[model samples]
Target: MYSQSHFVKALELLILLVVYLAYGSSYRSSSLYLYVTISIWFLVFCWLFAPFVFNPSCFEWHKTVDDWIDWWKWMGNRGGIDLAPEQSWEAWWMSEHEHLKNATIHSLLLEFILSLRFLIYQYGIVYHLHVVHGNKSFMVYALSWLVIAIARVTKGCFIGEREVCHEASNCVPHPQGHRLSCPHRFTVPSVRCF
Candidate 1:
């Protein structure tokens, strides 16, 4: 039985595929082509990022983070929170939620790869329209789709960096001096290696 997340992921992919097939080849219909491509790109965005937001592991991560939050709340009620407790809580969270950490890393990797694929397809479409068909206006309109694809890829890279920073946050020396860092940095090449 497919879980809800899996079902939704499948549905999004199906919609993307349908859009790509139905309107992607009609380059003469510049408006339709541009709209379909943009919609497809946005769907890809949802495909990649929505999992991070809605995945079961995300809820688990939230729950664990909330525990530290609860601890913070307790400290606040007791008057003045110490950094040590928070650092310890951070450590505990990291140790306990290995699956969440891995899922986040893996999802980011998938997003990057899929974004690249989308961009490549856009590039090909634009190149064909410009070079083969000599359709300047259509080419320009198609460029908009290309631009969005590039932006999405840039966003994916930015998100990847931010996730790296998040995972590394524990290592920075705090007032409490909690030195913790995941040795596994989810760099782009690491995705290829996997």
Candidate 2:
């Protein structure tokens, strides 16, 4: 039987193939070509990222993370009140859940790659303009996408970064510090889970 990654990769290829074949010849040289491309690409942002980032079962890191969480709660501490004996808890989890660290890292890596749509999207625009339109607005597009990327970064940290940071908190060390909203429940003092 095929695995989930196989199915997902097949679906991505199938979508690209169908979009390319159906419109490739007709829109090959049109200004609106980017429109069709962006539309399909937007579908990826909507469909793939959220599920991969939030759905714990996909990577099964939930089981590993939850093992510590369950143990923490059963020790008579409140769910949201306290994370007792933080140091020992962190160490024990690292020793026990170390094997799954790679899985969490892989999940985070996939997220980083997929969520790089801003760079990819900007490059697409620049390529389109230079090759197709060929006007001297390179700086304009560059600045435009730069500004957009800035907004994206701000939005990520303030808005959605919390969930993702939390998800990878145990396995990945973030430079943004704890400001990204990774609850102390998931984070330990180590750089990596191991």
Candidate 3:
């Protein structure tokens, strides 16, 4: 059963999805450009949800790299010791999986908070351009698409995604200094957003 908070979050997400789709469909964009945007949107989906499907091998690749922050913490024994029993591999993996799932999207909501701004921009800007102002010029279409592309990459790829990845990484050496490893991420189809 879904908790009250989960139900509320799910409702908010549904509303946002409807609004974004409405704005995007308000005016017919150029077919080719529309296709491209749809593709990028799928990529955005893949990027957000990749780690949980696999062991973070793809999106979580950053963890494999040695960072001075992590190195220092491990070496100095600062926050390295967990007196509680080390969790089993199965239990630890399951917990990490669920945490990443929630952070990335709660499979659909909490994680989507990372992309909340982008969603707002999409619905607001698209509606303003396509419906409110009725901007149908090729130049206007191009500019609007550019704005969305930038927002998608910057917000989804960098900002929102990094938050989940950071949370994913923190679980690595927990309850013991020996880092737990998760391997891989993968992706796929789409074609309609506008």
Candidate 4:
């Protein structure tokens, strides 16, 4: 059986492919198809070869930094009180200090790659529109893509373990953090903490 992470990743790739297809012939000519296929293949290659091409130490450090953010957020909310003054200070200090220490050169390099991915996505959209349908009626789609990209970057940098928090209030310091607890509310009472 496929693990949940595998399923999720596959679903995400499927959605990207579907969107590429749905944009229709106006968006999916031979050249566009080739470009999109190559882009997807490149992402897959990076994911598969990251351990070999990149330093495993660096990847672990990045993951640790991400986990530290969640730990601080959890520590802030563990006692069911929101924004206890001391806890807020603790969370902020710990998060900032850990981020400073853990944001290694490798992490920055990976971030640069991700930024390039965003640029590719943006330009791909424009190229598809320009070549396929030639209809520029929907500048809004491009704007939406930009917004989503910004949100994704902000979320990755600040939110940590995106699975745990859907809203800024849940991951960010706020006076009413408790009010913004996971909306799903499905309890796993015996789950082990890593």
Candidate 2 local accuracy as lDDT? 0.54
Enumerate clash totals for all models, in the order shown: 0, 0, 2, 2
Using TM-score as the measure, name the better of candidate 1 and candidate 4: 4
Candidate 3 residue spans exceeding 4 A from truth:
1-18, 56-194
How many pairs of residues in model 4 come into backbone collision?
Answer: 2
In candidate 2, which residue pairs get closer than 3 Å at backbone N, Cα or C atoms, i.e. clash? Answer: none
- Candidate 2: deviation at residue 23, Å? 6.3
Model 2: residues with Cα > 4 Å off, grouped in runs: 1-15, 26-122, 129-133, 159-194
Runs in model 4 lying further than 4 Å from the true structure: 1-4, 24-101, 130-194
What is the C-alpha lDDT profile of model 4 across 26-73, one tens digit per residue?
645568677877788666555555544565654577777876896586
* Candidate 1 colliding pairs: none
Task: List TM-scores for all candidates, in order.
Answer: 0.23, 0.27, 0.23, 0.31
Give the range where candidate 1 is weakest over 10 consecutive residues by summed lDDT: 185-194
Q: Write the per-residue lDDT of candidate 2 for residues 1-194, one digit (tens) a residue.
A: 13244446556655654646553575678868778666766665655565556756757777768866866655544222123334344344344444556678778788678768546645655564344366556676677778888876775654344345445544444486533333455653422211
Q: Write the per-residue lDDT of candidate 1 for residues 11-97, one digit (tens) a residue.
A: 656665664665457574677767866686676667666656765665676777986687686445421123343444434433444
